[model samples]
Target: MPRILAIDYGQKRTGIAVTDEMQIIASGLTTVPTHTLIDFLKNYFEKEKVEAVLIGEPKQMNGQPSQSASIIKGFATHFSNIFPEMKVVRVDERFTSKMAFQTMIDSGLNKKQRQNKALIDEISATILLQDYLRQK
Candidate 1:
């Protein structure tokens, strides 16, 4: 079966995650520059069978769309235009950064490593994918 992919989009960098071919387990794939995200996804889709793409939807504590939500929407629109056959879903992403930090601590990452924004983004993507899998 094809895998499900998740994206944690950011202004500077974007995190990517993917489920196993069996669609059982989700794992962090990589972090890429925001400018190159489309190219990265294009190459990835060409090499891998991705059934769907789940994007982290940033929301405020009160459930309103966050400032970055607009940016994400724009990206999603472009993504849909490029890959019309692929399914796209949005998953709420509140406190994902804090969760990612805690995950790093639990994983025994040092302060310096934990401070890496790219790593945090990757972890956030993983968390997003896991949550999506759970919902499924």
Candidate 2:
């Protein structure tokens, strides 16, 4: 069975998450540099069977596209072109960062660990995947 993948795209780093083969549970996979995202995905897809890719869509409080939205959209386009057979979808990610922070706190992460931006990105991706699952 193929799994669902999620991405939390950022300027410097990108977070990756994946659901179980049955698509029942979402888990953080890794965080990679933005410049290396495509290569990372290429290697990952070669090893894992992915049914779809879900990317977090950032938006402002007024529901307008956030500054980072354009960049993410560009990446999404490139991703589609690279993996024509893979399905890609965008999901609203309004407060995922805040939610990630709270999750880390609840998980008992130390202050330093909580401050790790990569960790935050991974958690945000996990949250995004979980949200997508709920919506489905």
Candidate 3:
């Protein structure tokens, strides 16, 4: 079975996570610069069989799409055009960042370690993937 990939997209950086070939465990892959995300995904796809890519969809507490929705929409459109065979999924990502931060704290990470935005992004991506798996 091909694995599923998850993305936590940000303005400056994007976090990537992937499931095992069995699609059981979701693990953080890496964080790449936002500008380099497409290239990164292309390179990763060359080495791995990905069944789908989950893109985080940010929404407000009031059930409204967040401002970042436009950016994600544009990227998703371009991604589909580039890799028509790949499946694209949008998952609600409300409070993922806060949950990731709390996870870091619970893991006993130091303040400096907690300050790494890339790490937070990675954790967020992992959380997004795990949640998706649970729902599936």
Candidate 4:
């Protein structure tokens, strides 16, 4: 099976992760500026056999749509338009960033690394992908 990719979209930065060809494991790919994410994914999908894409659907504690949801929805629309061959899926991303920070702390990352928002994005994407894997 073709590998799957996950996107953790933020206003300033975006985190990326990908599944193994077998779709069993998720690995952090890279972090990029939000403005450049589409171009990056375009290039990546051209070179990699990506079967689907997963985007984190940010939501509020009350289950209302978060402010970031609009931006993510726009990205999803553009992603589908750009890569009609690939399927796009959205997964709940509540508290994924918090989980990412906890994961970093548990992994012994120091204060500096733990504070790095870029790392959080990557971990968030991984969490999103892992959740997807679990549901499958």
**TM-score against native, each model:** 0.98, 0.97, 0.98, 0.96
Per-residue alpha-carbon lDDT of candidate 1 for residues 26-97, written as tens digits (9 for 90 to 100)? 999999999999999999999999999999899999999999999999989999999999999999999888
Per-model RMSD to reference? 0.6, 0.8, 0.7, 0.9
Which tens-of-lDDT digit does each residue in 83-134 have in candidate 2? 9999999999999999999999999999999999999999999999998999
- Candidates 2 and 4 compared: the better one by TM-score is 2
lDDT of 2 at 98: 99
For model 4, state the Cα shift of residue 113 in Å. 0.9
Relative to the true structure, candidate 3 has a C-alpha RMSD (angstroms) of: 0.7
User: Which run of 10 residues does model 4 get worst, by summed lDDT?
Assistant: 78-87
lDDT of 3 at 32: 96
Q: Relative to the true structure, how large is the alpha-carbon lDDT of every model?
A: 0.94, 0.95, 0.94, 0.93
As for candidate 4, its clashing pairs are none
Model 3 misplaced regions, further than 4 Å: none
Determine which window of 10 residues in candidate 1 has minimal summed lDDT: 127-136
| TM-score ranking, high to low | 1, 3, 2, 4
User: How many clashing residue pairs, candidate 3?
Assistant: 0
Off by over 4 Å in 2: none
